[model samples]
Target: MSPDLLLNQENALPWTERLNFARDIARGMEYLHERNIYHRDLTSRNCLLRELPNNSRQAVVADFGLARVVQVEPNTQPDSPRKMSVVGSAYWMAPEMMRGEVYNKKVDVFSFGITLCEMIARVHADPDDLPRTNSFGLDVEHFRQKCEDCPPAFLQLAERCCDLDPSVRPWFSDIVSITTAIIQELDSAPNGKYDITSRGSSIRRRQ
Candidate 1:
């Protein structure tokens, strides 16, 4: 398999690089969710970035080796039976995953959350200087610092993606909404000084 283009560290890239990367990832995950597919093994290595016809970069979620078709039941038992193997990166796996419990689409959400944080950090951070953490792990303060001055809408979305409880976390459709909103805000304010309260209002409006 080819290496993830976004993870390449040949040189530094602009903030837009990171934003576009995140957007592509969200889109790919949205597609998977629509098909009731859950990529149990989501990591930076599994996401590959390719240039669009317009010369913009887009992310493609790959490596479906651990993916499974999950049913969205109204009520799923925590101890339900699972057919797939229990294998995934430690840092990106959800808490329930660590407990060896059966999970659903929410597991992908948890991994996507970690991937977002990593992409944000990679935009401007030196990999060597980053805190020593596993692939699916994150340093919240470090993420906040790297994204300092980023629109609150984006920050909140990242936080929501990494929320402890998968039940409360937004689905891929909601993630698309948040990411779209953030992109719109960024386009309007190129300087990146966003209205936190106003952005919060927009998010609440969606909810």
Candidate 2:
């Protein structure tokens, strides 16, 4: 299931399930980053999920049409490799990318943050529902407001992923680390369900 359809079908997923989704994505991104590949367009729509036997869905990172291979310079950090082309969905594009500045693999981290926002807020990152554009950019304040009721740790990870400065953003491995912890906590919880009460509209979950 695509995340948009998943959210539309169930309104909102439980926190544990959402954490699982994020962890899956983080692991996927981590794998790609390890190979010096960047999924330039890492959005909810690009991720696919396969249903499991026990009322669970396993996320698979798909849609690599916009993916690029980073050409690392000798003795340079992986994130230091720069690319000039401006590509990827606008809603999830990093701030540096929107500015048409040279960007690196960290841009994917930014997109992952936006995808995480979608899972938490049950909303797409694009406020205007417009297609990706170099002239367009995200409103971070609005996004943060939409993330109300989201776990603080996850929200903080989102903030770090979407940081304006590419150097300040964490690597995909770091994301996998944090999400792994969150997933473990959730799995150890009662019935793997967190006591999350919706803050706004009723969040209908799938049985």
Candidate 3:
């Protein structure tokens, strides 16, 4: 609760910097998944944003209260992360988790998709409308259309991440790759500089 704020429409990040939001969060989640940590509660309220120079921003994932470091059995498949308890914000939760099924890190991917949608849509999420089983078709399409600057691949990735079936979701590493590629492409594009500025601010480093 250190950041103590949720990203919402009133405080929505500038549209041009959305890619930074995607890349930074994806990178952080990739690190956690790489080390076998699952952040069960992944939401805008659990993410912190620090202003940076050149109108860029850094997003940090927080709130690990429901997080778990799955322990692998000697003979178990490496990809089969054991489920502990049904935990996580309902709106961002995967269908498997809602069903109380033992699942792997894909649940985080489902949450990531919801978070990404929030970033692009620039609105506070309502959990009641977010359960994975409810078919977020309308919500997803609305966000997709609203994100004029967002790449098609990015939107596609978000939808895939929120797939009802956990097994169908892509890995965090794959998310990192796609986000990184999109960021690079945007950075190299001449017309992509719209709304970006040199704010002369550096990230706040807490001791």
lDDT string for model 3 (1-207, tens) is 122233433344443366567667888888998888889998767888887796656888888999888776888886784657998887677777878888898888888888777665544557443323354322565555556555566668888888877777888788878877766765554455323334311111122
- lDDT of each residue in 109-132, candidate 2, tens digit only: 889877877777776566553223
TM accuracy, model 3? 0.77
Report lDDT (CA) for all predictions.
0.64, 0.73, 0.68
- Which candidate should be chosen as best, given TM-score against the real structure? 2
Per-residue alpha-carbon lDDT of model 1 for 38-113, expressed as tens digits? 7888877788777789986677889898887777566865324454557777666765676777666777887787
The TM-scores, one per candidate, come to 0.72, 0.80, 0.77
Which has the greatest lDDT? 2
2 versus 3: better lDDT goes to:
2
Measured with C-alpha atoms, the lDDT of residue 105 in candidate 1 is 75
User: In every candidate, how many clashes are there?
Assistant: 2, 1, 0
Q: Lowest summed-lDDT stretch of 10 residues in model 3?
A: 198-207
